[model samples]
Target: MSTDTGNDARQQWKAWHEERTETVSAPYGPLALTGTYWIADATEGRIPAIPGHWAVDGENGERGGAVLLTATAADGLTVDGRPLSGTVRLTADKGPAAAARADHGGRKLVVIRREGLWAVRVYDPGSAGRRAFTAIDVFEYDEDWVSPGVFRPYDSRRRVSVRNADGRERGLGLDGELAFTAAGSGFTLQVGVEVDGTLWAVFADGTSGDGSYRFRFLRTPAPGVDGRVTVDFNRALLPPCAFADHFICPCPPPGNTLPIVVPAGERRVLLG
Candidate 1:
């Protein structure tokens, strides 16, 4: 019975890994992201190499900001499946790049807001990285890496300044910590609560930057009423930044780095 259970878990992991590969290699995935242009840096409302003139529609483009875009039909820009021949106001896209409000042929122009800053991301299906990608390197599934954990919510949310892959510091909000034990060693990870109550963590292990990606993200199911959850390191994921340099994935926060060597999850990006 125990052996059967382990086999089932392995099969599930395999299926999940396969789905992840397909998602990341899709036409509009992270590998397709070629650039992230902040509106503040646009000179005279022009972003180099990007069609359309873009500007902020709000004061200094603070929170709740929108973008003012001006384009001609000749630029081949489209919004809502119609050719955009004049100016339009666009809010940050709330969905995947493929579903963004604006497009230039097969390219997606997604507007995003981070900490009151507005930026536009271009996801081109013909990106070089996507074309050269093969697969994501992952370790064999090991049930030993899974552990029951407990979530401890803080009295109030807290934010910490952490450096991102782009070498810029950003605010990382923390809602609580996840406590768990594996291999008889106890560990705790500061985590953020997702909108749906799932736990998100950015962490690095002893193997980071050596055998695996510099850092990986872990997402655990929502905690039960009793704060019970499972920490499944087998599902540890390579951050978007690992697949594309344009991603500004945040670095691991203080005390979130584990001292152990975790070799049971995604290791790196495999490209040919």
Candidate 2:
């Protein structure tokens, strides 16, 4: 039975690795993100090389409003590859940018809304990061790194204001704690609940910025009624900031940084 379970785990890991390779290599995945231009950076409401005048509109705190993306034939712009004109109400990009159809020539223009603020991302196949990516250096899977964990909620949810990769300070909401033991050492990690209620942890182990990338993310499915879940260090993943400087990923908070070296997951990619 043990042999059979090991074989099944190996097969599952293989499938997951295959899927990850495809995801990162996709046309507009992290490697394809050439630029993220926040509307706040544009003085004349024109983003550099992006053909549109974008602005945020709505009541101060409400979520419903339109992002004015005005263009013309003279502007030589296209929405979903068709000549763009007038305004398009855009919500956040909930998926990969390649799947976003807006284009102007070879560039893929993605509309993104965050916290009711509007922005545009330009993806060019000629992005230097994509050209430089040689291979993702990852550690071989080790079953020992996978263990059961428990989630404990704080007396009340806590929010921390942290600096984003884009040099902006924003609130990162926390829901509870995830506690697990490995190598006879118990550790606790603070985590945020996603819209689907799953827990997400952005963390840095001892290997961070040394043997591996500075930070990694671990996501576990929603915990059981008892707050039990799997703590799978073997599946720890490098954040998008590892692949592109433009990604506005949040840094690990004070307590989220682990003291032990985690040598069981992804490290840096080979850049050419």
Candidate 3:
């Protein structure tokens, strides 16, 4: 690509970052996610602070299992701003929590599913994280840090058990390694293959925990037939774990940590 093309990409990325910051700090973004209640815990079919009873279906060979949310005015519930008194088949949230379109008074209820597990996230504008967010501090983009790299897939895919930020153990799927070099030092990161066959990495560097956030993510587009890819450190991003403690982001595995400091890309969000 020409220098002008690279500059255009950089400018577009800057706009994306600004938009993301605004979205996260919005009234009902991730920062406003106050609670995630698993439906399994609601044995009696009632979730606290959430309207209606939730029960799992489809395990018995039913079509598209649904979380039966029985709403009633007596339960202090209102769906779409109108007093609700019937059941609503809820699937996964298709948009932001604030725009979920399912509400109980001033609260927004979000339905989610993960590996067959069902849960509901409650988002309120009064969340502590939203109130504390001051700014998103990021390292100035350095075009020199962006370079070409290669992806090497393993003979077979592998799953590694890692502790999530929520203190739960979950399996992290890995597909290959992304090899790159920066500041005269070579590095390889374990990456997961996206559905489109691209590679992604969660990594930390010497600057982590001090000059910047502990860890960030890098995503390379789908590799060419020769496995060549563009490794853009200028687009390195701080994980959601940097902003919200409730997120279950995985830590970078061994060897993925670079010895040299990556002085480009996002650092941390300035909070009060």
Candidate 4:
């Protein structure tokens, strides 16, 4: 009976991993990101590959706050299906790529603000990374890597500054910590609580940079009142940065590294 249960769980995980792979290789996925152009970097008010005069909303193109895009009919830029002409005040695009403030020629111009600096991220379906994407390499299913864990929430959320994959530092917030045991060793990971009552963890094992990618992500259902939750290393995921270089994925926080090699989950980016 135990063997049958483990086999069923392994089969379910394989299906989930396969779905994640398809999502990553989607048309507008991370691999489709072409450029991340900061407004301060463009003195001429022109972003590479984007058709428009994208100037700053304040002071000689200085990135004081928002962005002011001046798109003429010739530029063929649009907002809400209306021809964008003259100048329009556009705050950062807080929504998804399909809901970007501006777009042209079927490409999305996503505006984002980070570290008080504003930038425009262009998502082009014809990106080289997307075109060259093949598959994600994952370790074979191993039930031994799955374990039950405990979650402890804090009275308030705390933020940590961590270096991102782009070599820039950013803030990563945590709601609590998850305590679990694997490979005969106990470990704890600071986790963020998602709205859907799931926990997200970014961690690195001894296999990092050797047999697997440098870091991996895991998401599991929120712990119960008794702090009971399942920690399945077999569902480990590659951050968006693993699929494209333009993404700014946060790195692992302090004490999240495991000394033992975790030979499970998605290991590396495998191109075919």
Which candidate number maximizes TM-score? Answer: 1
All candidates: TM-score: 0.98, 0.90, 0.84, 0.92
Q: Which one wins on lDDT?
A: 1
C-alpha displacement of 231 in model 2, angstroms?
0.9
Better of 1 and 4 by TM-score: 1
lDDT of each residue in 1-272, candidate 4, tens digit only? 39899889988988998898888887777888888898878868878778888777866346567888888899999987788988888898877787786888878888898877788998888888888888899899998899999999988999999999989889999999999999998989999999888999999999898888889998888788798999999998888888888888899999889889899899887765
Stretches of model 4 off by over 4 angstroms after superposition: 56-65
Kindly report the root-mean-square deviation of model 3 from the true structure over all alpha carbons: 3.2
lDDT tens per residue, model 1, 15-132: 9999999999999999999999988888889987788899889766545469999999999999988999999999999988999999999899999999988999999999999999
- The runs of at least 3 residues in candidate 1 whose Cα sits more than 4 Å from the true structure, single-residue gaps closed, are 61-64
Ranking by TM-score: 1, 4, 2, 3
User: What lDDT score belongs to each candidate, Candidate 1 first?
Assistant: 0.94, 0.80, 0.81, 0.87
Looking at candidate 2, the ten consecutive residues that score lowest on lDDT are: 59-68
**RMSD, every candidate, angstroms:** 1.0, 2.4, 3.2, 2.2
Off by over 4 Å in 2: 59-64
- Enumerate clash totals for all models, in the order shown: 0, 0, 0, 0
Residue pair clashes in candidate 3: none
Clashing residue pairs, backbone N/CA/C < 3 A, model 2: none
2 or 4, greater by TM-score: 4
- lDDT: the better of candidates 1 and 3: 1
> Across residues 58-162, which tens digit of lDDT does each residue of candidate 3 receive?
655223466777867787766666777888777787777766757876779888875567888888888889999988888887777888899999999988887
